[model samples]
Target: MERKRDYMTVQELTENEKYKFWYFKIKECKESGLSVKDFCDKNNIKPSTYYNYQQKIRNILC
Candidate 1:
């Protein structure tokens, strides 16, 4: 029998972790005075993905 490797798959992140990750990125962008595009580019994240996360945070707060 072969053992399965779940570690190779994508791991689910907790809500707190998600919040902290996005919050840090958002804060970094603000402090760096970089446009969203530049920040996402420098960070190797897609702008659309970053925007979606940003919108989700705003929606939850409202």
Candidate 2:
């Protein structure tokens, strides 16, 4: 069986596009007020990745 890849690297996405994509996703996830684990599970994102994305967004915002 062929496995589906979950995501792309920075080089694969334009800077603004990457920021916008995760910005909305993280915004929506946080708005739900779900635990990180539950949110990741619901959104099909890995815990570490969710965290990394959060940090990345924070860095971008600040």
Candidate 3:
């Protein structure tokens, strides 16, 4: 039997989808009233990785 998957792999996502996913994550972090370190820790994200995505999103927007 084939195993079921619950998450999409990065390789399976389009560029737009990847951007939107990270974009919403960054926005959610900002609106959560928590520090970057706290948010990342709570969400199981690496703070550096989150900052990188935030930078990428800002570059895209600006």
Listed per candidate, the RMSD to the true structure in angstroms reads 7.7, 10.8, 9.0
TM-score of each: 0.69, 0.70, 0.75
* CA-lDDT, candidates in order: 0.82, 0.85, 0.92
What does candidate 2's lDDT look like per residue over 6-53, in tens digits?
986677568778778888888888899998899889989998987898
Count of clashes, each model? 0, 0, 0
Expressed as tens digits, the lDDT of each residue in 1-62 for candidate 3 is 98989976777677778889999999999899999999999999999999898999999999
Scored by lDDT, the top model is 3
Q: How accurate is candidate 3 locally (lDDT)?
A: 0.92
Model 3 stretches with alpha carbons more than 4 Å out: 1-13
What are the per-residue Cα lDDT tens digits for candidate 1 across 1-62? 99976554333446757877897787788899889999999999999999888887778778
Error of 3 at 46 (Å): 0.4
